[model samples]
Target chain A: MTKLLEVKDVVAGYGDGPAILNGASIDVQPGKVHCIIGPNGAGKSTLLKAICGMLKVRQGSVMFKGQNLKGKRPDQVLREGICFVPQERALFPKMTVRENLRMGGFSMTDKATLEKRIDEIEERFPILRERRDQHAGTMSGGQQQTLAMARTMILRPEIVMLDEPSLGLAPKIVQEVFDIMKVMTEDGITVLLVEQNALMGLKHADWGVVLDLGRTLFEGPAKEVLTDPRIQELYLGGQKAA
Target chain B: MSDLIQILILGLALGGVYALMGAGLSLVFGVMRIVNLAHPSLIMLGAYVAYWAFRLYGIDPLIILPVAMVILAATGVILYKLVFEREARSAKYSEMTVLLTFAFAMVFEGALATAFTNTQRVTSPAYATDAIFIADIFIPLGQLYAGIVSLVLIAGLALWLKYTRFGYAIRATTQNREAAELLGVNVNFVGLVSFAIGLALAGAAGALVSFVFSFYPSKHWEWIAILMSLVVLGGMGSILGTVVAAYTLSVVAAYVGFFFGATWSTLTFFVALFVVLLVRPQGLFGEKPELA
Candidate 1:
């Protein structure tokens, strides 16, 4: 299968900082959930930022839909059908749920289609509909996460890159988040996420890409990566203590 | 009772202009985090624009208000591109922008000084010095007109922000810039347009200032302190807070000037600033910063 998105030997970091992503590469398949898991400082989040054009790529390239994303601004990358949800969820705290969603589809000039997509997204996330007028910050963590996900869907983006969606959520909400990722793939959107919970992330993802020392250490079927002895020893608490 | 009513009327009028001055500064700072030290210079420039138009073409300062706004807004665009755009890319934007803007302010002051000299100029149309009296209270026409115009502009701005798509982009940018950018909002464009809008508002206030107060190019030095007081007291980036603070403080200044002395009225700003800092450093409407 052709990769929907490809990050080839990308090197990137914050301003004037040492490279966090050193030649990190990934091949994301269309309509599949790909979870990137690694130890702390593994450059998982930096890889996502580099692909989405938030961080400037110092070397290599990010190709989405066969188009080189070099020198593109974050908004331009978003306009080109890639959306990013940062760890903070990036919602306007003072704005209402509906307003935040409107802002999410800001690139869309056609008001009718924008409103239509918003309506459809609200229908999909019924809680968003219920609290449509409420401030985003006032919502529960689960609802806010749902809103963040729903906001990304306003563009009907081909690729959605999420950074740590389940960092601070309850276990039930974490399951709901993974469930949402499944729904996202079923909706024809590619899901790329950096997850801290390796076991949960791999269990729910179709493909697991293991990253360490700013490079891809392993990539395989999620179950295969999960069962790998080396991965188990290094990441999954050392061969189950056997 | 009649004396107090007159003072209140005069104070509200002054407050209206103060709102216009504070709103632009609040917006630029809120959106760009650029403490545009050139703000008072822009205001002074606006007054000069109106003064020149009126003096040369015999047009009323109020009549040339829109033209002055457009001219100043264009200047804002130039300033943004020439000075701010490059500096914004730096890691030390907050610190660098302050010094850059202050330098720009001095450049503007020197230019105006060379062109117009240090002589005081006032744009006094026929009605500027006249007053409309109602039930033993008098309202100065110049202050009233300036106040009315400021209120109207403030209302227009509020509606635009609440209703329009571009306005929503501005608000989103103001709230969370990185989030706005990630969501496909062109934050650079937002910054450019907002900076222009801010200067345009200052121009409007300046046109009115030409009618109500006497000013030279160096008058901005004094005006900056006043504008700063209004912006800080209102809460750094809150437009509504700035407007409310403007009206409230102007009224207090009027009462103080009447009861105590004019010099004490000017001193009230610092006193209020000091107290607010001691009590609520975030100002009236600013969110309390979350402690990590």
Candidate 2:
């Protein structure tokens, strides 16, 4: 199958800083959850930033659906059907849930279509509908995370890149997040996830990309990488695969 | 009893204009993270616009308000493009903007001084000296009109922010700029338009100021301190906070002026501001500081 999105030998970093992603690359399959796992400072999140045009790409190219996205602005990238949800989940704190949903489809000019999409989102996440008038910042973590994921769906992007979706959630909430990942794929959206919970991430993903020292070390089927002795020893707290 | 009521009424009117000035400053800071030290100078310029239009074209200051707003909005575009935009890319943007705006304020003050001289001027329309007596509480028509316009404009802005698409983008960008960009909000455009709106608000307030108070080029030096106190008291970058704080402080100042003297009125502003800050350093509506 053709790759839905490809990042080839991309070098990127923050301003005046050494490249965090020296030459990281990944291939995302359509309608599959691809989790990137690595140690601290491994450029997992940086790779997502480079692809989504948040961070400047010094070299290499990001091709989505066979179009170059290297120099595109973040807004331009979203127009091309890619959305990124950073670790902070960047919700408008003072705005109501309904208002936040409206912001999600900001690029869409038609009010009817925007409201329709918001209705669809609210239907899928009933909690959002219940708290539609409540301020987003006041919502609990799990609810906010749900809203973040749901907000990305407002654009109906082909690919959604998420950085640390499970960072601070409880185990039950983390399970719910992975369940949402399942729902996303079932809805025909590809998910590119950077997760610190290596074992849990691989368990939920269809494929796994291992990043080390600002580069993609290797990638394989999720079960293969999960059970690999080397990966288990280095990242999964040294639990031998049964 | 009537004297206290009179002071309260006049204080509320002054508060309305203060809210307008504070809203402009807060919007600029909220959206672009620019303190806009040039804010009061822009207001002074707006007063001059009202002054000039009334003097030259025989236009009523109220009738010329929108024209002044447009001119000030254009001035905002030029200022942002020529000055603020370039400084935005720096690592020390916050600090740089403060200094840059301060310099811009000086330049504007000097330019106005050169063109119009340091002489005080007021826009005297037919109703400027008229007063409405309502059962022993006489209300100056000019101040009452200015207050009504200020409150109406503020309500319009509040509705715009709540109901409009661009307004949604602005609120989102104010909350999280990167996230807004990710969601396809043209943040640079939002920044430019918001900065323009901020100046337009200043112009509106200035037009009203001309009707009620005498102003000169250097008068902004005094106004700047007052405006800054209002913004700080309301919480930096909070429009609602600024409005509330403006009304509260203005009322306190009026009360001080009524009881003590006119000189104590100005001093009351800072005193009230400090008292509030002493209680809530983050500001009246500012979010509490988070641990790193």
Per-candidate TM-scores read: 0.97, 0.98
- Clashes by residue pair, model 1: none
Candidate 1 lDDT score at position B147: 96
Candidate 2, B1-292: lDDT as tens digits? 9999999999998899999988999999988999888899999999999988999988998999998899999999988888787766567887888898899899999999999999989999988899999999999999899999999999999899878888888888888888899999988888899999999999999999998999998888888888878888888888998999899889889999999999999997777668767887768887776879
Write the residue-wise lDDT of candidate 2 on A46-72 in tens digits.
998889888899999999999999999
Q: Write the per-residue lDDT of candidate 1 for residues B129-230, one digit (tens) a residue.
A: 999988799899989989999999999999999989999999999889999999988888999999999999989989999999999989998878788888
In Å, residue A189's CA in model 1 sits off its true spot by: 0.7
Candidate 1: residue B87 lDDT (0-100) = 68
DockQ of 2: 0.91
Model 1: per-residue Cα lDDT over A1-242, one tens digit each: 79989889999999889999889999999988898999999999889888888889999988888999978999999989999998999999889999999998899999999999999988888898899999888999988999998899889899999899998999999988888888888889999989988888888888999999899989999989888999988887764421
Q: After superposition, how far is residue A54 of candidate 1 from its true place, in Å?
A: 0.8
What is the interface RMSD, in angstroms, for predicted model 2? 0.7
Measured with C-alpha atoms, the lDDT of residue B207 in candidate 2 is 94
List, in order, the clash count of every candidate structure: 0, 0
